[model samples]
Target: MTYTVNCSILLTELPLLERPAAAKAAGFDAVEFWWPFTASVPADAELTRFEQAITDAGVQLTGLNFNAGDMPGGDRGLVSWMGRSSEFKDNIDVVAGIGGRLGCRSFNALYGNRQDGQTPEAQDELAVQNLAAAAEGVARIGGTVLLEPVSGAPRYPLLTAEDAVRVISRVKEQTGAANIKLLADFYHLSVNGDDVAAVIEKHAKDFGHIQIADNPGRGAPGTGELPLGEWIARSRQLGYEGHIGLEYKAPAETAFAWAIRQRIAQ
Candidate 1:
């Protein structure tokens, strides 16, 4: 049960390029992030700099997200959005390429919110097509594709562990791509009223990655009532040997103290 910081949320006080060093300074040797740029296909120089930043900081890039459109502006995902399918398709290789370069072996593709005019069936069909391709792209780099059940955005379809696992199953069936796996984010599942323990008990082996944040506030572990440490121990008991991503909100100054406490406790 190792831990990695989610730089996208933890260290906003620093520039994006500096977060890895900051995480390392805070006693983390590994980190993960959402798409760091607004564009899916950022310039090669930009990509190189991002990779260099991580290298210079000496922290492992453990996981990354496929470009989900406009994360700061509330666009939950782009691939499943009707007209943006092509954009999403084009970015699959870009994300995988970066992952390969960084040795990051896990990628999460968010299932976007339901559009007003599109039927759920249609959106789901498009997701299967895109995720299948995403799975293949990451597989080429010896990586795995992850499906996360994100909560807080009410319109996003995938809200529970079961919901994400359902999609993962479908993508595997449709694409014959066995690299697809679930990203079990405890905060989201608890926020959506799912039994977190039950989810871990049932699908721990099925999980490709595990992210954690306290519910109700989406903050550090002690900020809420969820038994964060207990759940993590349960995950270990169930045989999940992957990194536990610290995907919680905290100011840069205090980001890793709680995390370090948890790590020491483990």
Candidate 2:
């Protein structure tokens, strides 16, 4: 099995620019992140420094999230939000530029929370358009655009594998874009009450990437009730060939110990 550290969530204790080196020092050769910038288009210097950090640390950037707005302030994403379509579209170029330089071929596009005034039908239509645009943008490098069902945000409507796949099918049907796919984050699915095993058994081959964190506490594998190792093994057995993204939260110093043990045991 292969793993990639999600520096954005796992290495929150460190400065943003330093997390790549920290991940490399901890023995991971590949890492992923949410959009590290506050703005859709950060300054050239900021982009340079970020790219340089990854290059200097010698780690592969395997996955990245497209800029979702104000995550900590409870904004899930911008793709479907009313009046933010231009902001979301602007972000595609930046995402593509970074991915082009860093060899990242998978980009996660968080479906935004439903706005107060916009009808659900309106939001879904806009989401499909933006997702199709994202898919086309990343296709230049043989990249994939990922859609995930999230937990804890009630306004965000995509809550099951079926929900995400429905939109993916729409993108394909409307735009003829085959590059959009599902991002199966086990923690989110479990928290949202989806049968994780059944999801894997049925849709493992459709996943563009997989992220993991144990539920109840969103902690590392051993600190919670999830059979994470078994699920990962099952995913691989069912033909999910991409890296397993370690997107759990824990004390940075000890976060990876269980993962190391799992690897040795495997």
Candidate 3:
């Protein structure tokens, strides 16, 4: 049997359970999503149910993203509503619970707006504290945090790799947990003043997960300006053995399937 490289199928605006089966049919061994609390997802189910679905569907959820507070991509941050602590806790716990159930290897954090009247240092401290708390819960279930940096998003106000590296160092320092790490999204990094493969090499140690999409237009592999084949070759050469998430939106699964096979053939 030919061993296939593991890649994650991004599940956005799709039925949750169907995502895995669809991904499996598309020739992918794993799947991913920005958030899974929607009605279509498995947020209400217990941990066992989540586990059973993935096992039965033959899909592995490499990572799950936390609520990207105050952005089009997410639920507002924990502190967005100060007086409603329970709501915030519920949201976070729901995410953590799913991570635990699915054996999620990493968690993605979308840095949203800093709290009101807070200095940069204070906001940094706040993020570290929150991550540490979440990490503690995730540790029991064998999962880590993978913070993301995006361009043109409120969650990514800084929008640069240097900034992301700074956040990673602080997150690790605060959590002091081995599992808390980073997700390197090529499309965002390429827009945020980082060379695609060069940044991958520079901070590969901090990267616990990776994702990709074509620039100018978020599309299939062959439609982008990135030298994806070269990127994939170097990633393998550098000893990276984690999921390569295809977060782009394709018009149909046909292109996605073709892209995966193309990468594998290369």
Best by TM-score: 2
For model 1, residues 46-121, the per-residue Cα lDDT tens digits are 8999999999999999999889998877888875899898899889889988988889999988889999999999
Q: How many residue-pair clashes does candidate 3 contain?
A: 1
RMSD (Cα, Å) for all candidates, in order, is 1.3, 0.9, 4.0
Error of 1 at 39 (Å): 0.8
**What lDDT tens digits, residue by residue, belong to model 2 across residues 122-179?**
9999998999999989999889999999998989999999999999998899989999
What is the Cα-based lDDT of residue 107 in candidate 3? 69
Ranking by TM-score: 2, 1, 3
Instruction: Please tell me which predicted candidate would have the highest lDDT against the true structure.
Output: 2
Alpha carbon lDDT at 50, candidate 1 = 91
TM-score of 2: 0.98
Q: Per-residue lDDT for 159-245 in model 3, tens only?
A: 666676776677676567556666777888887777877776776656777777777686666787887657766776686677777
Which of 2 and 3 is the better model by lDDT?
2
- Pull out the clashing pairs in model 3: 69-77
Cα lDDT listed for each candidate = 0.88, 0.92, 0.62
